[model samples]
Target chain A: MIFYVVIFSILALLLVASGLYAIIQKDLLYAVISTGVISLILSVMFYLLQAPDVALTEAAIGVALTTVIFVITIRNTTRFEDENDNNKVK
Target chain B: MFGDYQNVVTMSVYGSSIALILIGLYGVLIKKHLMKIVIGLSVVDSGVNLMFVAVGYIKGGTAPIFSPSVIDSKPLMVDPVPQALVLTAIVIGFAVTAVALSLVIRLFKHHNTARIDQIKSLKW
Candidate 1:
């Protein structure tokens, strides 16, 4: 019982922190990685709560497949705009 | 103040999952990026699945199975319905994610940019 409390608290904290990181990240790729981590953490939390089916799905689809898709998209696109426009003005 | 052990765990899961859900919804509502929207969707899915699994747990229960020693006795087992539902949901989620990603790829191919504001061919 006590263990469950501790696990839940920790998982909840991690979830919040990951979500905040995902939002505040300057690099879009970093944001995607943080989001994937949030999914992974949630999957483990599901297992601890006795939801093995959900956990398995989250691990395979959310963490693995989704992350792959995001990374591919990021690779295909430019990461950031040229900030050297400011230097040219000077 | 449900005194049952299972009820306590269920309540805790609900509170935590709801918090996750709210954060996910806030992201989806505010974020402008296409990829971020997909991530938010997955987060919301996780919270809902957690709620389903928590509802299935029973106090001091074992899995539902038949054995000679307990064949005639009533068994208190966790519900399997949520597990089955979640399995179906997971597959459907995968299909949705695949379709969404394909659409994102097509959007990028048509327009040079993936930003929501930059792709404005439809806007008058």
Candidate 2:
């Protein structure tokens, strides 16, 4: 009903906002965190959509495992995305 | 009230998922950093998964689970096939992500840089 509509719209907007943040953020760590946030919201949406299996899998993998790997990769490399020298060459 | 209420609500899922996919594509094609490219790929995977699950939603449907209380609602259950397929897709996406990130790490270590433009030894 009204409740479903309200929640769905909000979740949908949040998903997009976080997705954009992950794409455009300057810091690699923040971008990684935003990706995790996107996954968390997606899991909830899966549950609301009556797919508990998907919700469970997403919660475990997307929120936890994927974020962990991304962070580890960032930790081993540069945290901030350096744009000056790289873009100048192209 | 909105005309055709269910469709309107579900429309948000479709629209946003498509937007996410486009945003991911932008990151992949435009970003110079290796990590950003990988993140974009992951976002694209999520968008696809979301769209698939959203497509399976049925009006007035219940979760496709078994119990003594809901035996009469078999036809009213949301599509379980997509749920199963998406489950496998999620796991496979994780594996693909792990492999891609590992490759990124290898490339970074070899070149001492994570920016894609700087790695030119492999370029033809």
Candidate 3:
């Protein structure tokens, strides 16, 4: 019981911290990475709760594929507005 | 922290996850950037996944597998339904992420920017 409680609380804290970082982050790439971390932690928490199936799915879909797609889009877009404007002049 | 031992902890964890979901929703509603919106969507997804996992935890539960040493012994086993549901949710989340990112990429390719304010085609 104690162990479960500790694990649950730790996972909850990680979720909150990662969510906050993702929301507050200015760089699009950074926000995407933070979101991936949130998903990865969620999968581990699922395993601890006796849900290996959910963990596997979350790891494969949320961590790997979603992060990849976001990185691809970010690579083709501007991270900051000011930098984009400077490129427009040249 | 309540009447029951495991139930109390499980409920607390689930409640916290719900709170995180709400925060993520707020981020989605308030953020103007397209990438931030995607981040909020992911945050919301994680919060929901946590709730699913918490629902499956059982106190002193053993693995669901049947062993030879316990022919007569009955052990507590955690629920498996929530885990399955969470797995489905994860797959759906990825599909949504893929589509959203693709839209973002196409939008950037045409407009040379990802900012919501810069895109005026749909706006009057």
Instruction: Give the best candidate by lDDT.
Output: 2
Of the candidates shown, which would achieve the greatest TM-score relative to the real structure?
A: 2
In model 1 chain B, the worst 10-residue window by lDDT is B1-10
What TM-score does chain B alone reach in each candidate, compared with the true chain B? 0.81, 0.90, 0.80
lDDT of 3: 0.75
Give the C-alpha miss distance for residue A36 in model 1, angstroms.
2.4
The sequence of per-residue lDDT tens digits that candidate 3 reaches over residues A54-84 is: 7788888888888888888877777743445
Show model 1 residue runs off by greater than 4 Å.
A80-90, B1-12, B63-75
Order candidates by TM-score, high to low: 2, 3, 1
TM-score of each: 0.78, 0.92, 0.83
lDDT of 1 by residue, B30-75 (tens): 7766666666776677677777776786655654556788888877
Query: Between prediction 1 and prediction 3, which has the larger TM-score?
Result: 3
Q: Residue by residue across B1-124, what tens digits does model 2's lDDT show? A: 3345667686778988998899999999999999999999999999999999999988777889988876775557899999999999999999999999999888878888889888888743
From the highest lDDT down, the ranking of the candidates is 2, 3, 1
Whichever of 2 and 3 has more TM-score, that candidate is: 2
lDDT of 2 by residue, A1-90 (tens): 788888888998999999999999988899999999999999999998899999999999999999999999987777878855345534
DockQ of 3: 0.55
